[model samples]
Target: MANNFGRVVEVMVSNMLFSMDKYAIEGTIPFDNDLLPNESEIKLWNLSKDTISRIKRNETLMINAGYRGDVGVILHGFVSSVLTKREGVDAVTSIHVLDSQDLSKRKVKDITYAEGTLASYILKQMVGQLGLPIAQFELNQDYRYEEGYTASGEVTDIIGKVAKDCGTSAYINKGKVYIRNLRRGADDVFALSKGTGLIGSSEPFEEEKFKGYRIKSQLQYRITTASVVDLKCKDFEGRVHVRSGTHTFSRTGDFMTDVEAILP
Candidate 1:
């Protein structure tokens, strides 16, 4: 098991920032940012009455967590709901958030593209309509519609279509949109070994005919969805593509990232 001491967590609600490690008596954040709109929850206990009162729906929420000197933002989304309940002598608040707001459910009116329009251009226009900032926008193949094309339906569906046509994939991370080649992973590649935070032996897995492993490591922000991780261990020694995962932190000594990945 990794040392994983000195846990740190920061929560920003709109302009208010709370150092969870100090202010919160207990909390846990579970996030899975993958294809489709990402949704997660933040639960904190024993927050000050002032802070809890100030939190409201639709406010921007950003969470960062890791060990000391290794922290990074793990989730960025808008508050969907906030509920507080009295448990024993503590007040526990559960805040639900959704990434990209309502963009995934928003319907895109029918838009026609003339022949010779690049697939990337269409994706850009659609994403622009959603008003979210773009982090990375690159496609493996920018297909040109020689016969023109029409786009309609949920914004996410159209994005999926464009990705399929261009042999790419689309997802939202930290409130930013990304459309990239299916075979390619994120820019940072993390190496995992016993010395590098690998928690235990990875278990082999096969899903949809794609073989990979289910891995757990000390909680950190570097291994997110679409991240590339090189595994060096007794059972596995190779690079795997992160498909989906959750970063969890709690006061009960449960700080880890559980990942589902595939060989790529």
Candidate 2:
């Protein structure tokens, strides 16, 4: 079912985080509506680390919504969240979009969506704009070290030393995204750290912009499902633009089952 796959897709995407090498960061950033649905105009803004391109809502979005009909979103939740971050400093509002309400419950189209959250921002940065080429990045491991004193020659400086971790530089690759780049497209990193299917918010109640964004969450745990059927879509097409999956993803038929599976 769509809802089931929604959860499954979340699971699979989260699963990808551990792999962390699917995409590499580059300096050449490209934006395409075909790869990622729900596209409107883009709002380019400034970031301390890099230049950010935000997708605006009020745009036409057509995915493999289903045989029943199409869902025209102003913008995808990821885009909405970026806008929310820009507009409202620390607040997020969203919805639980039950996929294809008209379809049968036994069918696969049923799905639910909520507003964005901290994790959403992480994923947005990881996925970046769908069509946009990979971006450059700087990676860092969030590890810390401790120092001990025994009245003898002090222990070596091991504080904040991460063994196998590396950061990517955006200026070098011309916006190319490497699996190692944290700020580039590191959505899976946080999810792996957290563990669960992710939910997102479109409108944040409180808005503020600091160096980039710093968040300490006020908690609420609520519940939530597809492959990405053929996702025929429009203008957006290419290798990265092209849909990648097995199990014969299609543009029609049981919409739920089609997009239920996660890519790779």
TM-score of each: 0.91, 0.16
Worst 10 residues of 2 by lDDT: 218-227
How many clashing pairs does model 2 include? Answer: 65
Q: What is the lDDT of residue 67 in candidate 2?
A: 18
Error of 1 at 152 (Å): 1.4
lDDT of 1 by residue, 181-244 (tens): 5348446889988888888799999877589989988886888877889998788899988877
- The global Cα lDDT (0 to 1) of model 2 is 0.19
Which residue ranges in model 2 land beyond 4 Å of their true spot?
1-132, 135-248, 251-264
Using TM-score as the measure, the top candidate is: 1
Off by over 4 Å in 1: 25-35
lDDT of 1: 0.79
Residue 103 displacement (Å), model 2: 41
Candidate 1 similarity to native, TM-score: 0.91
